[model samples]
Target: MDDIDQQLLLLLTRDGRASAADLARELSVSRGTVQNRIDKLKREGVIEKFTVELGRGEREHQISAFALIRGNADDDRRILASLRRIKEITQVSTISGTFDLVVELRCSSLARLDEVLDSVRSLPDVADTQSHIRLRTWRS
Candidate 1:
């Protein structure tokens, strides 16, 4: 992507609901240009999908944590499939380290988080998991 496209993505990241006209105004481009670029970004898979980012007050009731997972390389497909089925597993990333994956979990309550963790631990291929509960957030 070019500089303009990168800037457009930044603006959208801050507010996904911004109108085409507003985005054009900020980007100093025509509305049609903004819309066309957005379409191109989506078509090229640079933009996966758009969804709401909950406000801090709404997120305050939720519990979030990160899990560093170590598993058998051959069993990754099975382990990852199991993780993807759990709605609480928001994000997962493959990492080059002692851990094979880093998982992000968000649940409504501590009890629910405990249950989700238990379920994750019981997955057949998951050999080891280190969890860190987030106490507070200073940034998004």
Candidate 2:
């Protein structure tokens, strides 16, 4: 990706719904060029997927937390599969050090979060887990 491509990604990250014409205008490039670059980015896997960033009001009603999971390396695949089945688990990543995996969960209520946590704890391979609820967040 070149400078223009990088700039396009920044703009898209701020607003994924930006139109080709809008991006062209901001980047001072032709609409076709913007479209071509976006297509190339997608083909190259630089653009994995477009997603929505919830507004403050919407986020205010949701609870976010992180789960530090410890498990046997041999059961990584099974553990990941179980996590994938839980709709509240928005993100999961294998990590180093004390924790084998980190999971991000967002739920509408504390009760829902508790239920999700229970489900995660029930996984046979999950030996232990430490959870932290996010009290506040700041984003750029």
Candidate 3:
């Protein structure tokens, strides 16, 4: 990771789909040089994968919330597995500090959130849960 590599990474991070010729022009290098550097970056795992950012508003997206879930250590796997099976649950994390599990969910309405909470409350392992709705997101 030299200065050139760092610059290339910065450019690629902004747009992974950048063409070799475009990158070469931006970096003031030949196409072949850009290709080789990109190859090296990929080989070294500097760029793991590429993904697209979806427009949530136009999609079947719903209200999203973050939940702090407290549960017993023994039920960690089951609780996480259950969360994974739920389509609305997009992200789940075993967190430190106050929360055992941090869960992110997308729901159509408050009623849907209530339903989801009911299921979570029914889980014997879940001792408590605190949820907060997200008002807006400037960036993903």
Reference-based lDDT, each prediction: 0.93, 0.95, 0.82
RMSD per candidate (Å) reads 1.4, 1.3, 3.2
What candidate 1 gets wrong by more than 4 Å, as runs, is none
lDDT of 2: 0.95
**Candidate 2: minimum summed lDDT over ten consecutive residues — where?**
72-81
lDDT ranking from best candidate downward: 2, 1, 3
Indicate which candidate wins on lDDT. Answer: 2
lDDT of 3 by residue, 22-99 (tens): 989998989999889888988998888777755666434677888899987655988887777778887898888767
Question: How close to the true structure is residue 55 of candidate 3, measured as C-alpha lDDT?
Answer: 69
Local distance difference test, candidate 3: 0.82
Q: Per-residue CA lDDT of candidate 1, range 33-96, in tens?
A: 9999999999999999999877998888899999989996655888889999999999999888
Model 2 Cα lDDT, one tens digit per residue, 20-131: 9999999999999999999999999999999998899998999999999999665599999999999999999989999899999999999999999999999999999999
lDDT, model 1 = 0.93
Displacement of the residue 119 alpha carbon in candidate 1, Å: 0.8
Considering TM-score, where higher is better, how would the candidates rank from best to worst? 1, 2, 3
